[model samples]
Target chain A: MQIDHSENIVELKNISFAYGGKNVLEDITFNVHKGDYLGIVGPNGGGKTTLLKIIIGLLTPSHGTVHLFGQDICCFNKWSKIGYVPQKATNFDNSFPLTVEEVVTMGRYGKPKNDKIVLQSLKQVEMLEFRNKLIGDLSGGQQQRVFIAKALAGEPEIIFLDEPTVGVDLKTQEQFYRILKDLNKKLKLTLVLISHDIDVIASETTEIACVNKKLIYDNNPENFLRSEKLKKLYGSGVKFVFHTH
Target chain B: MEAVLSLFFIHTNMFDIFQYGFILRGLEAGLIIAVIAPLIGIFLVLRRYSLIADTLSHVSLAGIALGLLLKINPIITALIASISSSIFIEKLRINKKVYGESALSIFLSGSLAIAIVLIGIAKGFNINLFNYLFGSIVTVKQIDVYLIGILGMVVIGLIIFFYKELVYVTFDEESAKVSGINTNFINTLLIVLAALTVSLAIPIVGILLVSALIVLPVVTALQFKKSFKQTILIAEVISIVSVFLGIFVSYYLNLATGGTIVLIALGIFFLSLFF
Candidate 1:
């Protein structure tokens, strides 16, 4: 596949990061274009989420430069343009007395609450009926949908999700991916997803970036599956059935 | 007929107690503190930072002791000490220099130590110190009432201004930051408001029981599992009721104001648990 540097929305050049003496990511270069669905796959500690955090400016790399929307990350203040759904979205104190609508309204923090936008976001996730319900009362799958709605409430052009489907049921996971694909195709929203389900993510995303403490593979999913890079990251005997649909 | 008459008579006496200037001043301050404490309390309780109130209260005690030693207005000194310490605690928590609970415990005991030393230097506890320690309603001066009123409005106004951001940060801080909210500024603002609320509350709830005023009503309101706004409103109602009833009952029965208020709040909590 041919690459177009002029249309790049995110550019990371020679990024290296370490925690104390341990190097988590080293000399990584990647770019995400507008409206691209990029999947980042790696082992549990392979720095997939760390890379995502770095792109979002949550963590600074020890070496390298990150440019978001053609501007240096340090000078990039248009955070509303990029939405984020962190890992384990359910890890918050569920019993916190917040309604689903209240949680969604948080997407527009530092601004006046807008019921129309909140309702619209909820409608996108089909969670409008549960707006008045307590956040903790919903099932795990339902909660994940609400979080997606929350990210959507900001009307972001790009969204970065880290392990978003963890602990959800299989059917819900398929539905979740469908919703994401719909958003990407219909709204032309850029998505950066981190996942462990190699087969589904392989078939779902437009491009794949495999990491094992480094950028082991970066290209179209067809080449990723046809190539021998999966074994290099997941090791020998790692079996995966590439779903046609 | 006799029970009905006695009930009416007691209600009349309750209203009549407001005639005294000190009682009026105390009630005004107590009402304002009632509103301010739980407004901040709901956020603190939701964020699992309820201990911040207790830690700041202890620091306020040291400030009060310092004021007593120097013969200055204790409320002003307590205000300075608590606001400063609250900022320090927030920074320590943010910088990861100390575990949050460890920091709270350290400040709690360290400030108490300083307060004890100051009390000793001032020749030990006196009538004034006792009033400050346990809360004497009649001792609430007119100037304290004015100060409380001004600070109470400031706290309430800030909460109103930062309502959405505060709720967002309390619910999920990282996401709030991701969405362009300056979470550190919001957090610091909250702790500073908490400091002001605690210092103002000291004159009514006293050092030892001030946390109850800040925590109990909110916890009790949490029992209903209402929405965030509803929970805060319920907490305000519960706090106002407790403060008013406690002040009135203590006046008639000659009881400690802080203890009486806390007991009423505890009673509400237990009742909610039962329901």
Candidate 2:
């Protein structure tokens, strides 16, 4: 599961992000290489989502530079290569009148001739059968799948998901992670996932980046489990139980 | 049975009405508004800015009053006023201190106050003011028809060209911005278009009922479980049918044109809820 450093797709150099005068992320650094499943776990209000937003270019870091594909993140214009599934995707208005296929097609907006890609992306998420169904009619887990398909329709090399399992049932969450594993292993797509469930994502992701307003741990999941980082991030009341499938 | 039959035969009566030049011009303007209003309405309803349409309509009424006092084209004056006020409202919405609904309420009340004061200063309400307030299909002029036609073409063209972008922005604005769509420009353009639609629709539906023409059809369409494109198509169909039938009924029954049209759209909405 080790990713070569020379082939890093995302590199952050002393990334520090703040909202107004309040510091959200301070003096953080990390690298995501091709085909790396990097999981970001943090406590509530610990700046996890802000860090993801900074990396995805939704928010600018106040003090540091980001390099995507070895280019300055600000100037990197090939946004089609990086797909984003925002946290709010799960809470979209159920009355919205969009079909699954149309939602997927939104990912292909700036691209040319995406009919085949749209179907392929839907199939990847196993949602091809429900492509014509209204998005509001689908269950929350199914809607999340459609959102992932929307990101995939652009045929992106890297995908970033922000707390995607919120409000989803336990079984569906397991299935969702299985699909992410398949996307990483079969499609060779790099993934950056943010989750509050430290133990669950630690088991699934190859690398774990534990943060509490700063980069605490940036290593493989095994080392993350053995280290004192989890204890530092969350106090003695927090328990870590690793389950193998 | 006879009433139903006469209602059916009202199609011929509609033809007789259309034979007059002024009635024909009114029909032209009414049909164009039927299309443009619902197109703008879909976005407003989706974005939770349906009330903004109502506020802008009242603003257009003040514009019309100013034009009458100045002896100029009311539609042109209304267009200028609506666009200017819409930009101002957008700026207010962007300011962190002012909530969006608060901004809309301020404009809505402020514009109505302006209209009332102007009407009082200009020697009180006249038949012309009544016509502008409740709408008079028989009074539609050739110049109003031309203005509606040009504005209709521009609104329809913009909606068609930016169909996907508009849908994306409407469904999820934050995601659209991350995807590199100029969300601020699209949002401002949508507000401006809504303003243009309100001003142009005033003559056909009146300032009091213009938002109904823009909103009711979309609400009716929402009663069914359909796709976004389907919702828009159904909304347009409902609007067109209501405009034609409402105009015909008003002509034969001697009812107020704007009120009758809005009543028909409301009737259709109730029917949609039932079936």
Candidate 3:
């Protein structure tokens, strides 16, 4: 048998993580393919963020082998190929004296400075007009857009967002998801979004991974909504209203 | 007004101050610090490590006191003490056993206590201690000038080489780490550079007030709406002007040079609030 390595951008095998001797993730295994929008959903403290951290190499898994872009993660040095927006983007210090353009330019580090690419990223997020404005002066939703623009500035093949809409209003969140969906479809960019909203995960993502200290379900989002795994993960009286848009 | 300005400029007394070698040396040292202090301070303030500046300066004071008691070069000793303390602070921060500010306060008080005890043992408040405490740039030797110049160059050179990395880490450590930046190395290097800056500054800025040089100009610039790069440029300008004018005024008024410079910076900071 032959394997087509180009299909998969990320591969994980028997990954587990423990904090202070308590297990947060257990023997998790999954693969993210090129251009796939993967949504990871789980309960609070269920290790969704930790799993994303492990994938991004922010946290080292206690046990397992991981590969990115067909190379072992330990030896992978091409980090510009992927972008990460951490969970604290919404809570970044408001007084930080950085303009939007400067913040976005950080994403292009180790690469030659390119004003055009920076402008393109800002334009993609509809924040081009505010490029010269200080990040502290922006609203929460606007700041979120700027952070996404920062991640996009690098032109990465994959972008990982950990609760990108945590502090965003519901109306803005819908718009935010629309922009993400557009990026995935138009740019063919791979996305790995860790979110707690089950409905959003089921409706927006192409694939869903229900994680609760273990891999509960990993399949198409539609099947995930129809399955009983979500109820099992959340316990009795759990309700999920799936929306198709 | 123009005639009065011309008469003041032509007065021989005004030009005589710039002719003295000690005054010239003091100006040189002050100018170098004016450039490097706030350059490092912007990152320090942004990362919320401004208190570390104060802590390291106190540690350098203890080292200076010890060096004086042992008949050694105080600046070298101060550098050693500050670098070691910076390393320890980084260790404490990573350990997560103590709060960051608590770690800083511990070092701050510990070093200050050591300095006071040593000062008492060395026969209480000597001229040498006073000079170090309030800064006597008039006593700045040629060797001190060379050392400060070299150290300032190293700090500026390192910052230029690691500008992007430093900015990335300061803005967002977790994201920078994920982006393949060696965040631990950068963090340690930043603390080390900050320690070096404090040590280099002590001879001219004094132990009690070195952080003012490192922090005040940046804060003043923060009052303006500007890009990070622009803020740094404005901060450099503010620092340079304040240092030169402070030294000039201190010479005429016979005030402590360090305190004068810091007061000028404070004045600028307050003025910026209204803008």
Candidate 4:
């Protein structure tokens, strides 16, 4: 609950939450500054999703007040400044009959911006051609791209993506991250990504925070491996595999 | 002779229609039901809360039985009983104990049972019971028009203004809750709208027929559009077309109005399966 709130975009101070007599998150404290790319990783039943919910203002902490951009998270009226790409599983409904353009257009809700953000969002993810096709007919890669496009439609300052690469093949996963990196660099968009993949996240994210019911490790990825503290966080017999081409 | 006379019903000629006050009343009632039925139906289909609709309709049937037993305007009593049933269902169908459908089913079966008992309580079943049970196009009234129009506009207005929130919530309720949208109020608002539509349409398309009328249009459109906006647009179109065509066909062929419309809708739904 001792988050530094001086000039950060998101500051969580001593936040704790429990549901139905079971504690999911304990007195966790952290601040995400503007333009910071924070990646979250942890084992199952970890509070990674729970923490993301708190950031998105979905679940209020049992004991702490969240501050966003120098004000309370509850006070932030403008949602366009915070673009979100919920999990791929959450966005796609197989039985739904929707075209990619129609799904993408929903990104325009609640805020007014130029069509550039929409098209650019789609273009960045290489989904511009499939815009006319039904989302139900799309391949996994194209579907993922459409969701990312929709998320970026608002052109927010910070983008929150939860488990963006759950079931896709390794190549598409790599492609997705590469596209995200390009957008982050060219558009200068702050990214907050959550993934269960240890190796990929370790390489791609500028900052890493290992979470399991608490903010166990929050530091730069370069130092993440060397720290005995972080090594302990990942548990025993941890090994990283590297492929040489 | 019945076919020829029934086709005469479709003439709907204002002058000749009112010269025969029965036809005039029938037209008024049909139009009123047409407008309100779809107005209430959209949310029920969207929330996938069809059981409540089914339950309410059955409960409304019991109210109609009371009217038959006492020899009063069954429609008023039907509306009252349906609304009351909906209220009771809403109270117990909270986030605790069992699923929402279970609660709806309990009331649904109870109401249907009560209606059956009432039928037994009276003498030979009134012909009116069949009209309310299935469908009847010969019963529209002028007062029903004003009521349907006013309530229909209010419900549609609320939907349009809050369209985005509704879509967002329907897509993923948890996310909507996190975004600070009031899921509870919106849910109740949707149900209230559904109840109003049920009452409005029950007079023409009886409880069973109206249920199909409400859900069929929405379900059929879902086959063609995944986007909430487009689906709703398609649903309204299908509903209007089926109503108009069913009315015309039923009038000309001496058929049940509700059944004909639902058949037309089912035809469209089957056609979409091929598409």
User: Candidate 3's residue-wise lDDT over B1-275, tens digit each?
Assistant: 36633544665477788889999999999999899999999999998899999999999999999989988889889999999999999988988879999999999999999998998898875687788887779658888899999999999999999999998899899999888999989999999999999988887878889999999999999888788898999999999988988887778767889999999899999999999
The residue-level lDDT of candidate 1 at A90 comes to 91
The DockQ of predicted model 3 stands at 0.79
TM-score of 4: 0.86
TM per model? 0.95, 0.96, 0.95, 0.86
Candidate 1 docking classification: medium
lDDT of 1: 0.89
Question: Model 4's CAPRI class?
Answer: acceptable
How close is candidate 4 at the interface, in terms of C-alpha RMSD after superposing the true interface residues?
Answer: 3.2
* lDDT tens digits, residue span B1-275, model 4: 36644557656542453565545555666655555555456566656786677778888889989987997777778778877767666667655565788888888888889988889879647678888888775655566556656766776687778766666666656545544577777766666667767876787678897788888888888888556556777877887777777766666566888888889888888988886
For model 4, name the residue pairs that clash: A1-A14, A58-B178, A97-B225, A97-B226, A98-B226, B29-B140, B29-B141
Residue ranges of candidate 4 with Cα displaced over 4 Å = A1-6, A74-76, A88-92, A242-245, B1-43, B63-94, B113-125, B175-180, B225-230
Top-DockQ structure, candidate number? 3
Recovered native contacts in candidate 2, as a fraction? 0.54
* Root-mean-square deviation of every model: 2.5, 2.0, 2.6, 4.4
Q: Is the docking of candidate 3 incorrect, acceptable, medium or high quality?
A: medium
Clashing pairs in 3: none
Ranking by DockQ: 3, 1, 2, 4
- Chain A TM-score of model 1 versus the true structure? 0.94
Clashing pairs in 1: none
Predicted candidate 3 versus true structure: per-residue lDDT over A33-150, tens digit per residue: 8888999999999999999988888879999989999898888899999998888886767778799999999988777899999999999999999998989899888898998999
**Chain B TM-score in candidate 2, rounded to 2 decimals?**
0.96
